[model samples]
Target: MSLAPRAVLVHRRTEYEELIAHHGTPGQAAFFLASRGRSVAEVEQRHRRQAEALARAAAAVPLDWRRTRVERADLPRFLFEPEDVVVVVGQDGLVANVAKYLDGQPVVGVDADPGRNPGVLVRHRADALAALLPAAARSGARHLEERTMVEAVADDTQRLLALNEVYVGQPGHQTARYRLAVDGEPAEPQASSGVLVGTGTGATGWCRSAWLERGGPLALPGAAAPALAWFVREAWPSPATGTAQVHGLLDAGRQLVLTVESDRLVAFGDGIEADALELTWGQTIRLGVAPTRLRLLG
Candidate 1:
């Protein structure tokens, strides 16, 4: 196995306890070590208390602790072979500090406040964990092939961590124009400061705000799942000024495009850009979704 149950790849999160309280392997299971000691002495003390409590749970799970592993979590000294990991989480995001050698495990969050509503907690936790766990052991950092897209110009499949949408809003900027084309199909582009093309998975973030302001169609806001709850938060103006005539269906890979622009513009993602590729107002970018997305542990 890549990681022993209580061995390495441990990330300490705030509610790691509350989260573990719910999804933790119930039966007598050993914890490789104790408190990772990041926050303070008091915090370390809490790990001992929590470990003891976990030891006494009705499930009677084994909470055996080895020596205090100190600051790092790693593969057991004897288990040199690598195994994919199951990230242990708690109520306070990811228990980033306590768990052992979480070097390359598929980390998952348990829940922040399972007490508030146990069912809800598991629903979210499971949703996140299901996809994350497997990725840890099997993923290779490379774009195998593009199997996704949101617009016809590129792929926007449900990538784990998406680069995000583009928004050009400053109140005073005039909307840009471009002729839309899917593989060179002429679909005239409308005028807008900038058009936002987000991964279907990223429909809710700030891009949606732009959607609302632009009077775009009211899409149902769901959990970004295939059939999750979707409510029409906001949309663009009448006639869909910057609508995707053939926003090709993105699957789960990379995308590429070639655009011929006739204007000057710069776009933003999440708000800032580390790099920019100029599109002469109408040049198409072969934007493809990446295969790997990092899981932000608690």
Candidate 2:
């Protein structure tokens, strides 16, 4: 007999939970929020709604199939099987957070609060999972929309993937110093805020902001394009550093290389700062299009 497909639901911690975690008690959390002119009742309501949506999604799972629930913070430690259908329930960012860990598994992005949240990535309604789950298990390829991803390889050892963008900078967004090279070109030393490399899926985010502020000829890539865009933020000209090669495209056969000249630098993807790679001086990191793509289901 064949094994039934598994549905893995991915979610994040609620604001109320976070507050309580930090403050150690609901009363303390409420007091802290009240001091900031916020109401604990609002947090309670949001948490209640999220719990209801999660329950509904879980209830929709077919009895024949196995089911699992995971938190966003636990994704790095979670092992995903090939036959598992990944369902992310939260804001658009949650989908991005989960995409990097998946191989080619079909992802259903469920908008937990559709009325209040602008869900560009999480587009499906919570109630639609009942129908969507079976269809996805049966014909995932037909409904799949592939999105390009960015990969960073450090010293030919550690590798990190991103659904949206990779941030290479200091711990606190401080000005960083590094030597950059693109497509086998001469490396140029630079002093700036940091470097941001993103795929077409991330064009509407941080990459878009950088593109608007600094004029670049190359537009962001589309979802299915096998290309990436890179921007050097606030490249300050100094006697030791140059700002000439700051923005460009990273298509196939091309790669962006950064050598950390600072005492320490951190590289993270999909806005997960907790799980980041630490780079020291003289460490080289390469950024390019990853071989794997995110198969997002509509």
Candidate 3:
């Protein structure tokens, strides 16, 4: 006899709480905001709303399942079991943050303040979770949408997955130099800001901006497509490096390989800068469709 699957509620600290944490007191935080002409009362109200939303989401979890709450900053160290169901209560970025830590778990994104910050990924309100949870747990439920994910593997060891995209660049937003190759084509040296490898879920984000700039005809992949898009940012045409292979699609059975030419390059997923992989000169990183996909509860 197995136990009921655990329900993990993921959340992040509010702006008011962060301010108080940094200033060590509410008065100091208020003063800091007042000095900058920001409204401390508004911050307090937003925090109150977030607290209420969290309470509602937690109470809505099915009584048969074990429940746990985790903060966003602590996601990397949190241990997730195979049978766990992840529920993120925040904006769309929170969903992306939790996605990297999960391995095929069903994720439900609960929008805390739908009126103020509408999100594409967070399609459900806190009040809807009562009915959403049970349906999500049932087998053969059509409420789940499988979102494509991208992966960055360094030398067959360090691997990082992203629901949105992976950024391989130099620290401090400086120029990055690397050798790029698509599929098994000959690698070419590239000098630019960095490279962005994105999935269908990320097409509307940074990838969309790049695509719009290039004015390419091909559309980005959809949610269920098993493909990836690559764009080299500001690829410089130097005497040594060429811009011919700046952007392309990585279809199935194909890969985009990048060899580090800079002294040090960092790879991070989903805009979480703190958690990253360091690649030194002569090291290679392969980017492509991840083997695992995110099962988003719609």
Question: Whole-model Cα lDDT per candidate?
Answer: 0.35, 0.90, 0.90
Please name the candidate that would achieve the greatest TM-score relative to the true structure: 3
| Top-lDDT candidate index | 2
Mind giving the per-residue lDDT tens digits that candidate 3 earns over 183-234? 6699999999999999988998999899999996467988779999889999
Between candidates 1 and 3, which one is better according to TM-score?
3
**Which rank order by TM-score, best down to worst?**
3, 2, 1
**What is the clash tally of candidate 2?**
0
Model 3 alpha-carbon miss at residue 210, Å: 1.1
Better of 2 and 3 by TM-score: 3
RMSD score of candidate 3 (Å): 1.2
Candidates 1 and 2 compared: the better one by lDDT is 2
Q: Once superposed on the true structure, which residue ranges of model 1 sit more than 4 Å away at CA?
A: 1-163, 167-175, 211-264, 278-283, 288-290, 293-298
Error of 3 at 6 (Å): 1.3
Q: What local lDDT does model 3 show for residue 267?
A: 94
